[model samples]
Target: MTIGIALLTLLHILIPIYWLGGDLGAFYSSTFMTDPKRTVGERMMALKILNNIDMAPRTTLILAFPTGFALAWAKGWLAVPGFAVVIAAVAFLGWLALAWAVHLNHGGGAGIKRLDIAIRYGVLIALALTGIAGVAGDVAIPFFIALKLCIMACCIGLGLIVRRQLVPLFGAIRTMTSTGPTAETDAIIAAVNGRARISVLTLWALVLIASFLGIATPV
Candidate 1:
């Protein structure tokens, strides 16, 4: 393989590694952050660390599509033009910038967060449709690649669900910090965390399936 293709392949391979590994770290850190035995200050510190570590997976998710698209184009798997890939890459970069802007601001702006949510939903729908079309032979996408797209769509959907679930958790955390953790607030945190745990585990499973499909493409 040419150096460019090899590099693209390397990036495609590395993204999932960081995504899964970072997710594991974030999950464990969350346990510490949510532990009632921990001091409020200690929990907040762990939360900060969790947010920082979460950027890896967040960034990788944004990169995954464009990298995979470009790699597929290079490998003659995609029939799209080179310029189409360029356009897609530029668009992904814009999305990445928007995502980081929201993250770095700690989700301060409601308007920007809405925009981010809209973008994610749009991408999720697009991925699901494309995967279905490809698998149905309405598009030329390889079966494994098409399946990966569907997997990505599922991942994004779960991520959105987790994001929604965390809204109350964040509020509960603020309450705990200010009021020293009432039973109601602790219950809120526990309930939200429980819901989020299931979603996260499913997401991890989907990522593993996608990784396996990438490695062991079926006939």
Candidate 2:
């Protein structure tokens, strides 16, 4: 039972990181890389990747949250106020992400942009709180805490990079639609796609590393 509980806790931490990181990559590619300069085949491929990316994050979160709660309860960490707040915040963020996913699937006119922003901010806050609580509680080893902090920093850095790359892509895409593709548009599209690929690779690497660390020494 104890081993099983530890496995669950590790999964709770690792799965979310993988899912969210992969989905962010796909989102960046699909939305920002669509260009008239690209062939229809290329555009279709990007869309397919985006579609596949949607499922992982939702599935991971669905499993992670409950398992997380169970792990906390079993470990007696749920009794801590700071830990409880962090858990609750994660639960709320997971719900919002789910709602946004559903809305997008249904073609509902919901503010997905707002939800995206919320998820990013919520994740940063939750991770920061978790790190602080871990320090105060001495629940995790120093190496594990350091690993989690690095993963959290990577997550935030990815978001910032995506925003920086996407803003120019957004403008370029708009111009392509309204006025047709130009040299500037082509350049931005290529740059955005390159940055997005880098971001995706980075996230995948982070997820793998974090997952290993989480399992090797779960908190």
Candidate 3:
């Protein structure tokens, strides 16, 4: 049990490192990808790199919940039953599989993307409600853990918002590829990038806040 707790704690710690670091890389790559001054092929290469780098953060986000849950259980911070842990493990595996599938088959995985988005919405709502309830003393969750849950929900929400905002950018990319870059497409790309920056920065702040919560475990 000691070994298990140590391992779980280590994983929980590493998650933020990958999540924030990977996102930083992806964010950097996107600047090059959306730069109209760059050749289309060059921009496309950057996009490829961004997508690959983004997988780390995406995977980490999915793992965060289960990893945190397991850690809490191991430390006796949460009274999670053995069967509940097993169920969570199963659900995490399924969600991870779906996320990877969508990433790998992005071009033709509209249905999968939709389903994944729906699942995210559900998780976001659950996390938010649970966090709020726990904080309000209506649930048995630890205050720090519940606070982290709310932060996680905010991160997930911002991710979804970024995705929605990127739709126009993606369409602009498609237009640039199919019809060559026009001022209109360039404007769209630049505009979307500018807008998405806010959410990205907010995500970084939220990640930092969550990291602090994990480290400090404030009362």
Candidate 4:
């Protein structure tokens, strides 16, 4: 591989490693934050840590798309023109900036939030359809790449679901902070955590499988 391809491959490998690993850390911190036995102050600290750690996975997920495509093009696995690669990079960087902007906005940027949601679902649906079409031979890409697309789509889809679920979960946390924990709050917290865990672990499985496909090209 040329230096560029080598670097792309290294990035492709590292993004998922950090994504999954950082999510695992965030997951652990979330458990502590949700635990009823912990003092409210301690749980609040865990929440702070969890929010910070979560950015790793979120950023990685946004980045994986362009990086994956660039690697494929670099390796001659995909027949795309040079300008397309630049377009992909521009789109990725733009989305990355929007992601951080939304993060820093913290729900204040209603318009920015809507734009982010549109981009998220747009990519998700595009990948899902790409996978389906490729699997059905409606597209010309390799099967392993198609599978990777599908798996990546599934991961993002699950994460979106968990994001929606978090509205109530975060609300419950606020209530607990002001009114102290009640049985209702504890149950909501536990239930939300339980549901999120299942989706997140499913996402991990998809990420692992997709990473293997990218490396092994198992067809």
Q: List model 3 lDDT by residue over 1-219, tens digit each.
A: 688888899999999999989999999998998788999999889989998999998899999999988888887888879789778878987998999998888646789888898999999999999999999999988899999999999999999999889889888888988988899998998899889989989999999999999889876
lDDT of 1 by residue, 136-158 (tens): 98998899999999999999999
lDDT of 4 by residue, 65-84 (tens): 89999998988888899889
| lDDT of the candidates, in the order given | 0.91, 0.62, 0.90, 0.89
For candidate 4, the TM-score is 0.96
Error of 2 at 117 (Å): 1.9
Global fold similarity of model 3 (TM-score): 0.96
The candidate with the higher TM-score, 2 or 4, is 4
| Model 2 C-alpha lDDT per residue in residues 1-219, reported as the tens digit of each score | 679776866777767676867677666766534566676456556756765675565455334444555565556545545567467657766665665575466434457656655665676676666666665765453546555655765666675576677667667756766777778777787777778768866866776776676557654
Segments of candidate 2 deviating more than 4 angstroms: 2-45, 48-69, 75-90, 97-112, 115-119, 132-146, 178-180
Off by over 4 Å in 3: none
Quickly count the clashes in candidate 1: 0
Model 2 clashing residue pairs (backbone) = none
In model 4, what lDDT does residue 149 have?
A: 88
Arrange candidates by TM-score, descending. Answer: 1, 4, 3, 2
